[model samples]
Target: MFDKVLVANRGEIAVRVIRACKDLGIGTVAVYSEADKHGGHVRFADEAYNVGPARAADSYLDHEAIIETAKQAGADAIHPGYGFLAENAEFAGKVESTDGVVWVGPSSDAMEQLGEKTKARAVMSDADVPIVPGTDPIEEPDAVRTFAEEHGYPIAIKAEGGGGGRGMKIVREESEIEEQLESAKREGEAYFDNDSVYLERYIENPRHIEVQVIADEHGNVRHLGERDCSLQRRHQKVIEEGPSSALSEGLREEILEAARRGVDAAGYYNAGTVEFLVEEDPDRAPGERLDDDTDFYFLEVNTRIQVEHTVTEEITGIDIVKWQLRVAAGDEIGFAQSDVAFDGHAMEFRINAENAAEDFAPATGGTLETYDPPGGIGVRMDDALRQGDDLVTDYDSMVAKLIVHGSDREECLARSRRALAEYDIEGIPTIIPFHRLMLTDGPFVDGTHHTKYLDEDLDTERIEEAQAKWGTDGEAAASGGDGTTTQELTIEVDGKRFDVKLENPGLPTNGAGQQAAGGGGAGGGTTSASGGSGGDQAATLEGQQVTAEMQGTILEVNVEEGDEVASGDVICVLEAMKMENDVVAPSGGTVTHVAVSSGDSVDMGDTLLALE
Candidate 1:
């Protein structure tokens, strides 16, 4: 076993990796950015280091800083927990080449071959795995039109290095081909540093199913079964469950075998997920299951531990993360494929810090005044926040995950309702109300909900009613600290990180308080804090001003100082929480002044431009 391992991520996932390392009797090291200096993961690890600033590009995604920190901490291996540089093949190659250090994932060559969508599709096709009809890397808008002509309307343009709906766009007609194609390419470049994209025949109503597979260096592979993630919003999964209620026994077996076959053909190792899009029969009854002849197509391969892996763990009684460590240490699989048997049904609910009624807008700020999670049999809470910890709005909004297990799907749903009701979080907005509403929803409870159900079919008024009944009111102003204070400083001695604290007798309270959390409304209020890297506020500007709705970095400035634009025209693109959003003109006008550039970071309410 390795002596020590460094976790190159943040939030609950980082803490999860550290705990797994500790279970194997290995020392753990943590690296955090300036915004995460007081993160729970840093406090749990044996040693921690400050990598860079709050911006992810300068901190969590900085390859050189993370590698150097691992070396200085005397760690022998590095584990990337999901996001950031988890599936980055170049970073894996760098770690592989570093002496005396091991990368706890697949080989760089295998990652490059499977991480790209087109290449993986080729590999799966060659392995006799059913794949959706799609094109290779496309360059122009004409290519998209041609594909749509053959595949019919509603084509999906996906980025080469994209997953979890980051760099994917949907075009329903020829008129939207050019704009959607450009937006997809821009998001690809901003998120994955790859401008390449491909086309696929979009399945209108399909269940998002995925199989969890793990392999070792000795050619031993195992599949833990399948998970259904059809409940989604904006193409991102909201709730995931294992042992799908919509699949027959024979159909489930086929999917499991296909997942194993694809991974084995790609020569992949460690933990990975093989996702598929299974077509749904709308004419079938509510509780009907898909037969063996049902159509299913390979979607993509997630090259790391998934956010919903806990569901599989609960049902199969397997320690997937520990297996990741053991496989990296050159251990062979001791159990056969037949030994993997699921015990019960499990569901994982992502406790994101967002208001679901208001289109799921991410929360700006606020402290966790009352952070209480439910406990008992068959309920697991994976989180890193304490009672008084302030919510971090710089990264993903998912602060915790609630996984419930039971003997059957009905029992699982029943337990989930109770668990969600028991979860208490104040001073910030969360989607607990939405989860509760889903438990009572007809299609979801009957296992007939598809990937587009939330975005397309569900009535918005029901969501509003749920939020009004059960949502938390986070509009109250947060109280600043008392008189006494302690300041923490990070110092380095001989390239090793050490934290220093200094006490002060009398100090004034923070007059400029933190940004209030989102309430059950359309928009969250402003912040007393100053403007970010986007320069000063636009108080002097006279025309209609465009402001940022969330904290994010500018990826592109579409308008100049005096550019003519119509109403609803995109003015700029902002990258936040690993997703791209376009800031558009509220009304038709000419740009009077621009306050931000392509790479500037902006906080909520920061002015981006002014229009007349």
Candidate 2:
């Protein structure tokens, strides 16, 4: 076993890895950014170090800083939790090469071979695994058109190193080919540092199924089971359930075996997931199951622990994270394939800090005035949030995950309803209401909803109603303040965060403090990463300004000064919360001024361009 393990990530996953290390009697080290100086993971770990600023590029994604922190902490191993450098082959190789530190995941060679989508598809094809017809790394738009000629319309332009919909775009018509292709490549480069992209024949209706597999250094591999993540919005999974109710016994076995074969063929080890797209039969009855003949194609591989690994844990009595550590330490499998058995059905709902009624807009700023999670038999909550903690809007929107287990799917749904109802949150907009609404949704309850169901089929009015009924008014709590005469200062010593308190015995409290208590304070306003308010830019900009709708980095400015644009024309692309949003022109006009460029950090309402 390792003496000390450094977690090179933040949020719940970092806390999760720390807990696993503690359970195995290993020391844990946590790395945090300035924005996360007060993060829950930092408090939970035995020791913590500051990496960089709030912007992920300078902090969480800085491979060198994290590696140096691990060295300073005397951590013998580095565990890159999902996201950031988790799947980066270069970072993994660096950790592997470090004198006394080991990387607690698959070998860098295996990650490089499978992390790239085009290469993974080639490997899967050689292993006789079914894959969707697609083209290799394509540069020109003509390649997309040519592929579309044979594959037909609705082509999926995917980044070579992208997953979780970060660098993916769907083109449904000829006119959208160039725009979607550029956006896909731009996202690919911005997110993965790779502009390489490929094409796939988009499946109109499919169930997103993935088999979780883990292997040890002793060459023993095991498939935990399958998870259905069809409940998605814009290709990002919102909910996931294990032992899919839509797959028959034979079909399930086939998919699971295929996943194992793909992993074994790639010479992979440690934790990984083999994703597949199972075609859904629209004409089939509501309760009908997919048989052996149903078409299923390999999607891609997630080379690290998944967010919904909790679902598999609830159904199977296996501690996947523990196995990850054991395998990395050169341990052999303790059980055979047949010995692995699933106990019951389980589902995981992502508790994201977004408003589903407003197109799932990520919250800009708010404090967790009240935070309460449900608990009981068959219910588990994985989170790192605390009451009064201000919501960190710098990274992803996911606040936590809710996992529910039951003897059967019916009972699981019933229990989920109770758990969601019992879950309470305040001062931050979340998708709790949407999850509650899904319990009564017919298609979802029948387990027939495909990956595109939420994006294309669900009614918007019902979501609005759900939000109106159950949603919290974040503005009130975000603007509210508590009276205090003492002011605290945050200081850093050798890249370690520390808090200092300064007290004034006779200081007047009736000025700023009293006004803050009456709803006027720094908490009432949101500042961009560049330390500027969006409203300030809007006030000075002239003409018809196209302002950002959320806080993110400007990935691309489509129109420059003097460029003519029409209504609904994309003026720029904004990357936010791991998703890309197009900022379009409100009306036909000529571009007068461009306020932002690629790689500029922006907040909600910051002007991107002005039209005359």
The models' CA-based lDDT, in order, is 0.87, 0.87
lDDT, residue 195, candidate 2: 91
TM-score of each: 0.89, 0.88
| Candidate 1: segments with Cα more than 4 A from true spot | 476-545, 564-569, 578-580, 586-592
Model 1, 1-612: lDDT tens digits are 999999999999998999999999999999999999999999999999999998888999999999999999999999998988989999999999999999998888888988999999999999889999999999999999889778898999999988888789999989999888988888888778898999999999899999999999999999999999999988899999999999999999999999999999999999999999999988767878999999999999988999999999999999999999999999998789989988989999999998877788888887887899998888998999988998999888988999999999999999999999899887788889999999999999999999999999999999978876677435321211233334446999999999674444344324232222332222334322222222355667767678887898899998899899998888888887667888888888888889899878877788888878
Q: What is the Å distance of residue 244 in model 2 from its true position?
A: 0.2
Tell me model 2's lDDT, rounded to 2 decimals: 0.87
Cα deviation of 44, candidate 2, in Å? 0.6
- The residue pairs that clash in candidate 2, if any, are none
